[model samples]
Every structure is written in structure tokens, then in C-alpha cells.
Target: MSILITGANRGIGHALSRAWQSSGTEVIQTARNSPGMEPLDVADPSSIKELAERLEGQPISTLVCNAGVSLDKFDELETGYAPELWAESFAVNVTGVFLVIQALLPNLRASRDAGIAPKIAIIASQMGSQNSPAGNRFIYRASKAAAINLGRNLAVDLESDGIAVGIYHPGWVATDMGGDSADLTLDEAVPGLRKQIDELTLSETGCFKSWDGSDCEF
Candidate 1:
């Protein structure tokens, strides 16, 4: 069995891949059309299907849907966010997550049959909080909120099959997405995320948590 992490070429995804690899766990790292790695555009159904076919019947202990985007980061509420930006963000951050899990269900089931409890970890955001202090980046927040809802429902549906699902906020980090002024570094975020993922079990499915293990409101 192995772990599959989407968008593993950089940022939090890359950090999680390294952490698992350092512990001698097999890791399947993906990037969006990147060379020397599995090319996976999470927004593309064809991409998800092809990867699923290729890994068919293989046991996957964990699947991390970490590929996401924040396109309207600098957009102002009055004049900036185009409709297309919302579509693009949802394609990657919301629908993409559901597609990956659907495509990989068989793999997760295989792990369960093999006496391993498989997992699905979604990299959502605290900004998606239902009681969010609204001011900016509504597009990003909406997409993440959808993802959290998806994870929760999926948890209920996949429970009979023994697959656990978790949605988490990977803290503000100094990545290309999270600017240098962010609160936590990748170093701090990845370890906390790892702890959450490693401890995930069927009983704890559908949890909304922060990288530091703090409880988050839906």
C-alpha cells in the first residue's frame, strides 16, 4: 500500500510527501503537468480517470487531495473577481476533490480488504468557516466551504467501507499561495498535519481541524 498526494511538487503537498518518504513510506507524488512526476490536473476528469486506471487494484493507504488554487487573492470586492475566477477555483478546490476520491475508492477498498484502514485528507481552509469574518477572497472561501461539506458527506458514505476522511486547514505558510507574511512556515504546518493524518480513524471521520489540531467550526 502507498500514499498518494496531489500537488506534491510544491508547498504543503511537497512537504507532506517528504515527511512520509523520510519515514520509508511509499509515496506517489503528483503535479499539474510537471515533468519527472505524475502529471495530474485535479480539475480535469480525464487526468483523474487515467491515473485511476493506471493504479487500478493497487492498495492506497492514504489519498491527499491537496491541489487547490486561490485565483482572486488580490481582487477587490467591488471590482475584481470575475465570474470565471469562481468557476476555476471551484473546479480545482471543490469538484476536483470529489473526483479524486470517487476515482480512488476502489484502491481505498483494497486497503481495507488487506486489513489496512485507508484515509482521505482534504486540505481545506479555516477561512471557509461558516461564520467567516467576511472582507475578501470570497471565491476562495466558498470553494473551501464546499470542499468541507463534501468531505463530511463522503465520510458518512464511506464508513461502511472503512475509509476515513478528514478536512484540515494547513495553517498560513510561506508558500507561493501563502505569502511570506503568513503566520506559520511549512516546517510547522506539515508536522502538525502529519500528526492529524496519522491518527485518523473511522471513528474520527468527518473532522474539521487545523494543522495544529485545533477544532474548527464548520
Candidate 2:
């Protein structure tokens, strides 16, 4: 069985992929446009279908849905959050996540048949929490919230299949998306994320947690 990480060309996904590889774990890295990586545009159903067909019988022990966008981070409340932005954000962040999981169910089942309890880790954000401070990035926050909700429901439905789903807030790290002022570095965040995924079990399936494993309120 192997781990599959989406959007692995850059940011936390890149860091996570490298870390796993360095540890000698079999990792399948995918990106939308990166050379030397499996091509996948999570927002594109055809792209997901192609990937599923290619990995036909491979058992995936872990699936990390890390492809996302924060399109309106700087837009003002009134003029921001364009309709197209909402559509694009949800397509990638929410619907895309569900589609990938649905398409890969067979692979996850293969992992189960191999005696592994497969895990799905969704890289949601603390900004998605209803308790989080109100933000200007309305579309991004809402999409992440939806992702968390989707993970929760998937956890419930997949329990009988021995698949665990955990939603996480990858700490705000210094990246193109998180900005240089963000608190944690990739070094600080990726390790904890890996730990969370490693320790996920049916009992912890529906958890919403921070990178450090602190429980998060939805």
C-alpha cells in the first residue's frame, strides 16, 4: 500500500511528499501541471477519472486532499467574493475533494483487503471554523468549512469499510498562500500533520484538529 498526496508540487504538499519519501515510504505525488509528477487537477472530474484508471488496482493507504485556492484573500467585503471566485473555490476545495474520494474508493478498499485501515486527510483550515475570527476571505473560509463538513460525513459513512477520515488545520505556514508573516514554518507544521495521519483510527475518524493535534470546534 502507498500514500497519495495531491498538489504535491509546492507548499505543504511538497514538503509532506519529500518528508515521506526521505523516510522511505512509497508516496504517489500528483500535481496539476508539474513535470515528473502524476497530472491531476482536482477540480476536473476527467483528471480524477484518468488518475483512478491509471492506479487501477493499487492500494492507497493514505489520501491527502491538499489542493486548494484562496482567491479572495485581499478583496474587500463588498467588492470581493465574485461569483466566479465562489464557483472556482468550491469546485476545487469541496466538490473536488469528494469526487477524488469517491473515485478512489476501490483503491481504499484494496488497502483494507491488504489489512490496512486506510486514512483520508483533508487539509482544511482553522479559518473554516465558525469560532475562528471573521475574515475578509469569505470564499476561502466557506469552502474550507464545507470541506471539513464533508470529511466528517465521510468519516461516518466509511467507518464500516475501515476507512478513517480526519480534517485538519495545517497551521498557517510561511508560503505563497499563507504569506511570509504566517506563524509556523513548513518544518513545524508538516511533522504534526504526518503524525495526525499516522495515528488516525476509526475512533478518531471524524476529528477536526489543528496541526498540533488540538481539537478544533466546527
Question: Across residues 127-153, which tens digit of lDDT does each residue of candidate 1 receive?
Answer: 998976676889998899999999999
**What TM-score, computed on C-alpha atoms, does each candidate reach?**
0.98, 0.98
Give candidates' CA RMSD values in order. Answer: 0.9, 0.8
Residue pairs of candidate 2 with colliding backbone atoms: none
What would the per-residue lDDT of candidate 2 be over residues 1-218, giving only the tens digit for each residue? Answer: 59999999999999999989988999999999999999999999999999999999999999999999999978898677789999999999999999999999999999999998899999999899888768578899899999999999999999998999999999999998999999999999999989988898989999999999999989
Candidate 1 local lDDT, residue 185: 91
The lDDT values for all models are: 0.93, 0.93
Off by over 4 Å in 2: none
RMSD, model 1, all Cα superposed?
0.9
After superposition, the stretches of candidate 1 with alpha carbons farther than 4 Å from their true spots are: none
Residue pairs that clash (backbone atoms under 3 angstroms), model 1: none
